[model samples]
Target: MTPISKKLSWVAAVGLLASGCAETPKELVDARAAYKRVSTGPAAKTNPVQVADAKRSLDQAEEACFSCWDTSAGRDKAYVALRKAEYADALSRNAMAGKDLEAGDVQLASLQKEYLSGVNARVAAENAAAAAALGTLGKTQAQLDADRAAAAAAQARAQAALDKIRGKLTQDERGTVITLPGALLFPTGKGNLTAGGKRNLDPLMEFLRTDPRKILIEGFTDSTGKAAFNQKLSQDRADTVMNDMIKYGNIPADKISAQGMGSQNPIGDNKTAEGRQLNRRVEIILLKPTN
Candidate 1:
């Protein structure tokens, strides 16, 4: 070793050592500070995935500025910037999930306001639907009232027509008239039909046949006799009249149905002498077929 060469080598070694000893950061301290800031916040434990994303962003930021770690302050600032980026990443992750950002105490505060507005709009729609239903009900009630009025008018007309004929209906009397006068219909209380009863019913039967209206021969007896006695007598008289009309009057059987009303539906008052006479007669009411 020459003296000059040794001195140069020694100087070079001192320069290198001085450069290494310079006050500069080896690792980013600011990044750790920013990470601490985020970790200490409210969602630190509740949202571990968000915290993890924040840490990853900070690490990435630190990695991006590896060439500029000459001073401790510069390294700290770089790490701080990294933590800022991490916080932004965590916020973005929370936004993708379907949570009210503000109410959820997460990233996006504006989204919570939007959710409340939508809920209010739905309430307003329901109110509108209820109003529409009420309107329909009112219209239906009005139509029903009109229909009721029409039905009342129709019932009134039918009642008026029924009241006019036959004066108030009364109890009946059957064989009383049949056994009186010129040859009793079969001489006595016998069931055999007589020519005379046939003769009387023929004109009416023929008229009914021509008009195509149904005829009914209902017989009745005065209340003076036993109920069983009158029932048989009345039924016999009705049957006799019915057969005569069918055989000689050319009346359709379908258009006639004979019944013994016994002592029912008297045309005149049964208390009066004339009332008994009127009630002994046969009655036929026609019923027209409906189309």
Candidate 2:
């Protein structure tokens, strides 16, 4: 061979070797990039164990690429390494988010504790101020004891008076209530008081005259009638009872008021006759003294 042709053949061989050495599969390149990204990111700190696993997978892929005879084997290993790196990164981010959530919960708990403490402090301060004001008003411990005794005596007297009255007597937040049956007081669908009703109310009037307590007369009816009719009838009956107490029972008009409850606040099952009878009633509430 000629000298020039020999030199050209040697140069061509060198070029081919360089080209083969420089060429790398796309999967391997992608895997190397993914591993580097995860190792350098928060995954390095938050998920060190997973990041180490990802590094090992990348090393295996590099070994496969350099030593394995088959290109597909190298590619498959590279794909696995890429997936491991991505999983590590995802896990790291999730762990970081969980930590942030934990921190927020701690802060929220602290805020709630602070709020409760503030409320307790305010309430204690208010109580202290009220006690001081009471002291300034010349309310000694002896005076306070006397006031409590007086209040207890008043309650006992009211209870004793209520026990003497007939009808279903109940005590609630509104005061003492006496429920009188509508059947005994009036004929069905009528507003006028029956003879038995007048007799029943006579005791109530005498009690009121003696007790001198403020009163409210409320009328209720069963669900058998139309709502409008029931409402009007209840109002008329309440008014009639109030007028009778003022005229005959000698109760002060200024101390008594009347209202119609209609079919509201049923005392029993409306479907049964006994329940309906129980529902139709008049309620006289003896209000607590303003003192």
Candidate 3:
């Protein structure tokens, strides 16, 4: 015989010799199946001691199964062993469930602690940032108030200087106005500025540099000329003044506008030489501030 076959035959003979007194019964079969199911389940890994106890009970029940139906003592022994096997399986499963519940409770408590700690840290950071922003805003508001006050004082000084430059000027509901005699500024029927005319405009230039006010220069003519001739002459004179202001006074050209009145809004009648001279004049209007 082969050596491997001889060893397997010896093992089988020993198993039969140990179970010689038992005849497998339905109760023993059921008890063995129940033990196998529990030993393969998660309870075996968590409660191996209880699984071993269930296996022992199943072995005892198989031994009692030989005469379980014919003898009362054997039947009673088989019933007791079956019950013990079932009880061991239930105990093992219950122990595993209790261990899982305890682990879950521990993990939940740790997570709650971590969550509360993170929330507190975030709230502290937010509060600190808000306090810093409020401090910066307070300083900014103070600086803005100081700047506004300085601007008001500077504007007051500029207004006083403007008054001195335009002698005999009037402040009506239309704002400040300055009148210049046409004879002093231009020759008769001409747009050229005389030497004396240039000197007279020096103070007006100085005031413009500081105040930066918007200006409108209007020129007028007497009724002695044709309407078209008068209109062109007045426009040329107004333009001459505006160009001189921009070139010599360093005033921005966009701040000033000029137009010809052509004898409109006359301060005197145009019949006499004196009244006509008065009608032929230039007027300067200064705009007011918004604030």
Candidate 4:
């Protein structure tokens, strides 16, 4: 061997031995312990990606130990690897927590949307029901109004027909009244119906038979006669008229009544013939219908 080459080889071997004798830094020991804990512990199964990253860092640190030969540079590498390994584990846990929180938020949003839809559907149903009820009420009210109008029109026709047939009518609190002179129904001082009276009453009797209205026959006499005689005569006259109406008109007996108001509510003075004639009268009162 050449003298220069041999001397260079001997000097390099001595320098390598001196470097090997240097003490390893405490940071390297701690770095190795940290790497072992992460790779072989629970983190290896649960956090495989993080554990792999930690193993790479540990490999780099061990390579630095051989390259730098226990110098501070080697310890620095181990320290960096330990920090990186811890960060990987913590980052993986935080990511799992974030994913769980995101899923929870999505589920809560879906539930809220479903609840709002139910509320809206319920409100719509209630509104529809209320509208249908209101429509029914309106229809009922319209029917009632139509019925009332028809009834009023019928009553007006009845009044017009009665006035045309029975002469002018006067309405009072009691009922509608038709007044007739005593000469039209009976002879002077007589309770019997005259032939002309019977003929005149034929149309009225037919009306009574058709319509079946309630009736009240009232008789009055002039004050010229004795009070007792006039009362009896008036009563007999009213009874005769009622009996004739029931027989000729085929009127129900239960629908008619008779009364005598002799010398009471006189229409005129008893001293004059005209006034006395006016005072002697028979009245027919028509009662209101039940329905």
Return the top candidate by TM-score. 4
lDDT of 3 by residue, 194-291 (tens): 88777667667766655556888889998987999999889988998888888998888889889998878887888888899888888777777557
Instruction: Tell me the lDDT of model 3 at 111.
Output: 96
- Which should have the higher TM-score, number 1 or number 4? 4
Best by the lDDT measure: 2
For 217-250, candidate 2 gives per-residue lDDT tens digits of: 9999999879999998898889878988999899
Per-residue lDDT of 1-291 in model 1, one digit per residue for the tens?
Answer: 899999999999988776654433434555666567667764465565766666776565555444343444456555665556466546745654535545567534567778888988998898889878877887788788866765454334323322432212222332111112112344344556567644444434434455454556667666657778777877877787777778877788887788887777665677887776666655555544445
| Model 4 per-residue lDDT tens digits across residues 158-270 | 55544544543566767767677787779989999999777656656755555545899889999986998899889888998899989987889999999988889897788
Q: Candidate 3: how many backbone clashes?
A: 1
* lDDT of candidate model 4 versus the reference: 0.77
Candidate 4: worst-modelled 10 consecutive residues by lDDT: 159-168
Q: Identify the runs in model 2 with alpha carbons over 4 angstroms from their true place.
A: 1-166, 289-291
Q: List the residue pairs that clash in candidate 1.
A: 31-79, 170-265, 170-266, 171-266, 172-263, 172-264, 173-220, 173-221, 174-220, 174-221
User: lDDT per prediction?
Assistant: 0.58, 0.84, 0.75, 0.77
Order candidates by lDDT, high to low: 2, 4, 3, 1
| Total colliding residue pairs, candidate 2 | 0
RMSD of each: 13.3, 20.8, 12.3, 9.2
Residue pairs of candidate 3 with colliding backbone atoms: 23-66
Root-mean-square deviation of candidate 2: 20.8
Better by lDDT, candidate 4 or 3: 4
Using lDDT as the yardstick, the better of models 1 and 2 is: 2
